[model samples]
Target chain A: MRVLIVDDDPELAELVSRSLAREGHAVATAADLESARAALVEAFDVVILDLGLPDGSGLELCRELRAAGASVPILLLTAQSAVGERVAGLNAGADDYVVKPFALAELRARVRALGRRRESAPSVTYRTGDLEIDLSARRARRLGLEVELTPREWVVLECLAGSRGRVVSRDRLLEEGWGESSEAASASLEVLVGRIRRKLGRDAIRTVRGQGYAID
Target chain B: MPSTEPGRPSSGGRSLVRRVGLVAALTAAGASLATLSVAMVVVDYRVTSDAEDDALERARALAAELDAEARAQQAVTQAQLEDELREFSHGDVTLAVWEASGRLAGDPALPSPAQDGCEASAGPDGAWMVCRASSASAGRWVLVGEPRSQLLAHREPLLLGGLVALIVVVLGGIFAGISVGRWSLRPLVRLQGALTAMDAAAPQPAPSLPRSGMVEIDDVAATIDDLLGRLRVELERSRHFAADAAHELRTPLTKLRTELELRAEEHDEGSHEGRQLLRSVARVEDLGELVDHLLVLASPESALRGASLVSVSALVEAVVEDLDADASRVRLELEDDGAVVGDATVLSAAISNGLGNALKYSKGPVRVGVQDTAEHVVLRIDDEGPGLGEEARARAFEPFYRAPEQRGTGGHGIGLALIAHVVAAHRGDAAFVDDGPGAHLVVRLPRHRGVRPEQT
Candidate 1:
């Protein structure tokens, strides 16, 4: 798998590349903004970016890439682990952010997570038993037959499916389904999850108790 | 201008109260004195002229009489003139005559006077005003005089009255000055009160100045408020920088520990090198925890995003579940479902610190409970630790203040302090109750559960 690592810190970049290479990824490293932008021209499955760079910020690069219609998954590396900074990165089109000096194992795990998501980028779909949900087309089918799922139910199903095995938090699901500024009740999210379960069969989604839900 | 530096507000010139009072008093007193002096000059001129005209009239009348007397007799004697003048002059008027040769015939005590008009002189009898006239046909000169004190007697009484007037005028000027000063400076007084009433001890100093209704003063206040806002931003940035730096440090430490664990896992669990690596990872974990607390403490209120609300009982239970290693030592009892409006990351950090602290210090089972009320909600963690000492109770919330007994122990002294900082930012309270057998740490949060429904 092709992976691009963007970081101004040569040592950190080299270390991450070496670690990911051990996991059998063809890792390419860029030390600054100009090099990273140049590297983005080549088709890469995932881009691991450091927020701070010598020439410019990674957030600026993420924004530019998204504006240029680059749909590759971008993961941000931030030295400041403040939630505000994380939200800013996300708003700028970064899929995820990890604090700097992070564990190679965790970084690899996140990159693998991104790779798993990227593998299904064109038509990301989820399946369990006879139930299959199409995320790109916002469709759901059971045993090759299209089943009508309400718009809200589809959103809940999509969010849970998108979380990939990780727990999709109640707040995140609410925000994604009801828009970011939505003050929708947590109970509403649960009800939507319950409705999705009823339509897609009972074992389709797993309730992770206080956190949120996950795909069965 | 980039107002990142510590700025002092420029004053709007002198104190309004002082300036107004001084100007009012000076204007009132000066106006009174000016009017009094102008009146004095006018009255003095009139009185002096009238007195001179009366003396001249008296002298001219006497001269006519003497002239007639001389014309009647054709040979009037000085003794006759003197006797006739003495009868006419009663209290202060005296008459004198010179029969063309300039010889005085009246009171000799009077100084040599003008022979054609009136003159005031300091005579031997007293101050005297005399008038002289001549009748050439009769070949006789006649003079009439009176004491000058009559015209000026009123001056002494007027001086006393002027003194009384001056006292009254000064008193009235002070009263006017004070009233004017108070009236104009009322806005400034309100501004001062607003400044003083500000909470200086807030975790984040908010120096918000109220509008004073005066243009210049309000402008000054606005400028000051702007500077204060910039200063707060600068301070918040620096504080967050420290937190960020510590967090950055933690990431590397966490990575190092993870690498150590992976390497150690590949080796024998009883191997010497594996044990050493495990010990090193434990040390890294401790450092990571310290950095996490610092990050929590350094975090400001601006980090709160959206209308994020989390369940108090659920969050406590989740934390307890995550710290599963101490499952046997900790007990959880949730009474009610309570919610709080806050940032999730910060709340978790604070709760983790408190729970970790109880587990570390307690030898017996730790009791965790949630008590939710309508107005407020509390999470109490009771540890079977060496409860708080007198000194610990007082300085528990102080940062980095470690007890001598627990100095070399696992827990950092900043845990409670970090919790306090978070609670203050959330507008809540963190307190320790030592009445129980162990340390009772209570975190009180404002219970705000807003359950907005999504339309069907």
Candidate 2:
């Protein structure tokens, strides 16, 4: 896999590149939007774009790439962990985002998830047994009855349902739900997963012991 | 007596209306009484003088008649003349006869004058106006006198009229003064109403006060508006500075954290060096969290960007479970799972901080309750700790303020402040209620009616 890292800080770029390189993937680094634009000519599996650049913003690059018909998955790296900033990044056609100072493992997992998005049209709904999840509408119904879920609960369930029939890592789910996969938040993820299982059913979400949970 | 306090009005001083009326009344009484007294004195003098002139004319006519009688009868005796004079006396007048030999022919008690003209004399018969007249033959003189009491008789009615005039003028002045006072104070009253209508606690800037067309009141209002504008600018500047500083710190902290974490991973798990590296990485993470808290404090309104309906009971339960503190000791009394509209992430963080504090401070079990009222959804966390004292309760929500007793607990005192910021941004209230033997933290948010529409 080929990865392009667009960041103004060389140290962060080096650390991320070194970590990804150890995972046996080819990584390219660009310090500014100009270099990033030049590097976009080549085919890449994933693009890790930083929000702030010396010359211009990475959002413009994300929009430019999408406007030019590039379907390659782009992930945003932002220091501003505010939900508004993340929404803005996603709205500009980025696939996912990680706040600054993110764990390398979480970043790699998000990269893997983005790379897996090849030639498959994203589904708006997922169904397993009597549990029906409408991702676009952010609603869930069991046996034709709507199951009430809070906003945070919905975020966790949406993440699980997005990767249907596959194991969703705990850190990734935490990052998506709580915006931080810290030790405290990881415990929150456990409690939240237990709630989702209870709302759906006992056999709704299968916990794969120390690994994570999956929806079949 | 009205109070001198600026805004509050107390009935401790005389009203301006009454003062004005009293002054007007005094002025009118003084002027009216002075003019009436002067007019009454002049009228009394005129009455007395006119009566004296009439008495003098009567005396002269009587003296001329006596002379005619004396001339008509040259052989008439003095006794016969006295008899004729005695017949002329009537009412309050006294008839006296004086001969040219300086002797009284009749009534010797009558006062004798040296020459003709009128004179006032006081004798055993009280005061009298007397006039002496000579006969045409100059052989005899006649004197006629009247009491002064009869001459000044009209003065009583004049005094009564002066008193009545004084009373009427004073009453009229009072009425005019009150009406004038009320008319002139209309603008001031309007200015007070406008000031009372201002909402000082609202997040939005207060609207400029309406013009009262009074210079002093309008000047005060303009000064208040200017002060508010300046305060708003100052507050905005500080918030922006805080946000910008936190943002600038993030990138360097990110590099340090990643480097420390990567370096810690390179060593064996149980090695002392590896443990030290992990601890350093944890410290860096703590710094990052501090930065995040500062950002939230700086701009809490921005946290509502992705607002949605959040269940208060569920949020409490989730936070309680998430706490690494002994979760088994927490007793959750979730009476209602009501919903509120806000950013779930920030709300969750605030709840987690609250529950975390309760568990950390209390020795016994912590009680967490979620109940919905008519308009608000309330969350209460009760801890059986040494409850916050009066001083602690006041300053607990200030940033970085730690109670002396809780200082050695090895945690930053930003939890409650962060909770306050989040609650205020959501237009909610967070308060500490003293419910005996524990610290009770109550957070109340406006209840969002119905569940959020299926999120789009």
Candidate 3:
């Protein structure tokens, strides 16, 4: 896997680059928006962009890259935890966002997930036991009968299914489902996963204890 | 921002309209009464004086005629004099003839004449004005008397007219006072309308107050506008300060966290250095969480920009399930699934904070309940812990305020404050009820009916 990290702070950028490289990925670093654009000429698996840069905002760079027909997955690194800021970032064509001071393990997991998602077209549906999940249509069925799930329930279910049996961390599920991964949201995630399990069968989703949940 | 200040004069007294009317009426009545009394006295004096002069003139004329008759007859008898006196007597006036020897000769019913040209004397019929005339040729004196009551008879109509005038003046004064009162207060009423139109909570500036062309009212409106503008600037400054501080600290914190993780990975699991590194990482995470809370408090609107409908029962059940081992200690009873409209993340966070406090503060089992009413959806959490004192309860919602007893519990003291802020933003109330045997934290939010299923 190849990765590009764009940030104005050299210390943070160097640390992240070294960590990703140590994980056996070809990692590149850019100190500002201009260097990031120059480095983007080469192909990369994932682009980790910071929201604030010395020369310009990373949002503009994201818009320009997307407008120029680059579909490579881009994950945003933002210090602001505001809903509006995240919404804007996603709306400007970023795939996901991680708030500042994030754990290195969590960042590695997100990067690996983003890189794997680009390797192939996502499966349109998932089936286990009597439960069948249709990702494209956003519907679920049990014993060939349509099952009802609230909007929040569907989001949590879809995130787990998209991971292709990989353990989707609790915090990642929270960010995907509730747009935030705060301590308070962890409780909601736990309850949401329980409801999904009851609807699809107790064995449909497995909990990875102290880590997250997975669907096989 | 409210206009009701202590220095402002109270309108609790008698209304301006009534006060003006009363003053006008009293003044009108006083002036009219004084004028009427003076006019009546002067008119009475003139009438009485005229009556006395008439009586005196008649007496002299009668005496002159008697003298002429005596001269004509050469020897007038007493009987003839009596005949002349009787002929001269008329209605409301009588004539009396007195001899030079001080003897009354005609009209014995009349009072004895006094020695005076004209004088008021008490007579059998009320009081009379009497005048004396002496004729030397006839050796007789003629006295004419008239009642004083007849002289003042015209004053009765004058008194009736004065009474009518006084009533008219008083009524007119009241009407004029009322008109002036309404006209003068028009500007103040307009000022009140302008004040009521302003919405203090809105992000937009208040509309400019319309001018009433009155100096005092316009001055007040201008001052209010100035105050609101200054307040807005100060608020904007503080919000920016919080946001900027958070942004500046994030990069360094991220570097520190990444360094700690890398160093921890190099050592064995049970090594002291590895354990200390992990603990330092946890502390950094706590600091990051604090920054997030500060940003939320500084700009709650930005946090709630993606609001949607959320079920209270579902959220509560989720928070309880996350408790894991603590779940066994919680007794959950959900009576309603009513929804409230707000950001799901924020609402859940607030609920999580509430439940976390109960579990942290109490050793015994906690009871959590949800109920819906006509207007509100309530979430009550009761913990078997020491209840807050009166002073603690009052200051519980203040940011970073920790009760003295709860200081060593290892919390940032912002959990309850965050709950208060989020609940208030959703138009809800959060408080510690005084239910006995424990501390009861109640959150009541306005129920949102007919929420869309997809949104919920």
Candidate 4:
């Protein structure tokens, strides 16, 4: 996953970026809202924004990103974390607020939580016995650790999970997930199912003979 | 007594009733004396006039009797005429008869009487009133005379009685005047007492004094009642301002505290450097200190006390937990949960605002603790926030006044003012202590030392 860190404190930014990088996530850092804006032009899974930026308030950038329909989760990191600032940060479309001098472990936990929430479905949490797929939160948890899924995998799973134990045709999965006609295809439905199996395990999805697929 | 007039006490100090009373007493005495004097004179004149009339009647009767006797015999001897005159004579009266020749009967020293009508004269004896009438049978004149002293003999006692009555009227008037003056001052005295007592304990329902029978006094009482009502309203407004100040400042304080806590880490250790990390661990503490003070300054005083036994430590812990700042930053290091008699809800309301404010503006890793003294329970919230300056502390409770540097910060400026009201209402005190690294807000409430250990 790629993430952008917006902050005026270059040292703090580097430290936070290095910590996140150790988790196998690619990170981009911006010193101010201007560079942050330019950095946001590229695709990123999440953003770490600082409220007290040298160029301008991080609130403006957070708001701008939300207004422009960027669906990536925002985690605000600031030194002056007052109650009102937290509320304002949330109001500006920040998914989470973490005060300065915070534990690195806590910040990482919150960022992951935000990312998971962004990947999940908002309205429904699909449950197949012990395995639950929260579409709004966009995280699929089986046993304990979540089964991470890409955006396309999420769309495909959403179609299958909506079947509620019924079989869904491969054609439907392609149409819903990729928005492509039945005749057009980039990745085959069988190959997508194989990737989901590797992450979720074989029992998470079931093949109905020659007709279609379903999740138990 | 509001106006000062020369030759008169100011209306505020003057007793009009006393003046009215004195004038009434004097006038009554004077009028009574005048009426008694006129009555005495009339009594004297009527008595003397009546006496003179009686003498004239007596003279006529005597003249008629002599004429009848003279005519009956065709002649009256001088000796018989003298006897007849003597018969008509009595005490204070003398009779005389006149013939064409000379005097015929009665006192020879008595002067000739006027035959036309009655006349008064000074005789050798005393003042005399005389009347003469013609003899019916012989055409002779007969006169009867009386002294003036006989007519005025009964009037001396009457004058004496009049003098006594005048004295009584004057004394009675004075008494009445004094009584009226005191009765009129009753309302003012009571009003003064009521006003004096208000400073110690303001009567909630307000004392509604009965109206004085006097209209002016009643009017004054009404105005005082109106004044009391206005004072109560002003007090209530101050209480509301306290609550509002807490509400207005609490939100921002919460944000600040949260933001600060997020930046703190384990030992502030970092692998990268461009900007120095807050390594002192106290940078956050300083911010917390300032916010903690501000929180206490934003609540209403009345809301800070209750009538139950409250454990100060537990209460502080709960309130701090409720704050919006990161919980990891706040460390509860309380040795004593000192007990106090107060309403927990009321106390918590005050605590909540302060906590909210601290959460907004202070750095995390804050320490909230409790200390108990002999007379009071102290709740202390210590944080690493910028401490309040000496100048800000002095006028901290003034409404709508911010520090010069904070003028443009979006503050409604009633936070500390409201807290002052809360402290006063609950009979508690709040102190913003500047102790080195952090600002400390210490709230002291009167302790309860009774059997309330098991209470909330």
Specify the highest-DockQ model's number: 3
Better of 2 and 3 by TM-score: 3
Which residue runs of candidate 3 sit more than 4 Å off their true CA positions?
A18-24, A119-190, A193-216, B1-183, B203-207, B267-271, B300-306, B312-337, B400-414, B452-456
Better of 3 and 4 by lDDT: 3
Q: Best-fitting candidate, measured by lDDT?
A: 3
Worst 10 contiguous positions by lDDT, candidate 2 chain B: B1-10
Give a tens-digit lDDT track for model 3, residues B1-456: 445432233467556666766787788788888998998899888777777787788788888997898788766677876787777766667888877566556665556564648887888867777778877788778888877776667578888998999899889878877666667766766776666656554444743677888998788878977887888788888888988998888888899999888888888869999999999998997788777777777764545433544567777887787677898899987766645666655677678878888889899999999887878889999999887888888888888899899889988788889888888888889999888977899999888664322221
Q: Write the per-residue lDDT of candidate 2 for residues B358-379, one digit (tens) a residue.
A: 8889989999888878889899
Candidate 1 Cα outliers beyond 4 Å, as residue runs = A120-216, B1-189, B196-244, B247-270, B304-307, B452-456
Off by over 4 Å in 4: A1-216, B1-46, B68-87, B95-113, B119-128, B136-140, B165-207, B212-217, B231-456
Relative to the true structure, how large is the alpha-carbon lDDT of every model?
A: 0.70, 0.76, 0.77, 0.65
Write one digit per residue (lDDT tens) for candidate 1, span A1-216. Answer: 789999766666666776778789999999998998888889998899887688888999999988998888888887665556775786687766676545555677678766765654534777776767767545566545444443456556666776668888888776655545355456556655654543355577788888888885
In model 2, what is the error at residue A152, expressed in angstroms? 8.3
Model 1 C-alpha lDDT per residue in residues B195-259, reported as the tens digit of each score: 65544333334447778779987987788777777877777788769766895685467457656
TM-score to true structure, per model: 0.56, 0.66, 0.69, 0.32
State each model's C-alpha RMSD to the native. 12.3, 8.8, 8.5, 19.5
DockQ of each: 0.11, 0.23, 0.28, 0.02
For this target, which candidate reaches the highest TM-score against the unseen true structure?
A: 3
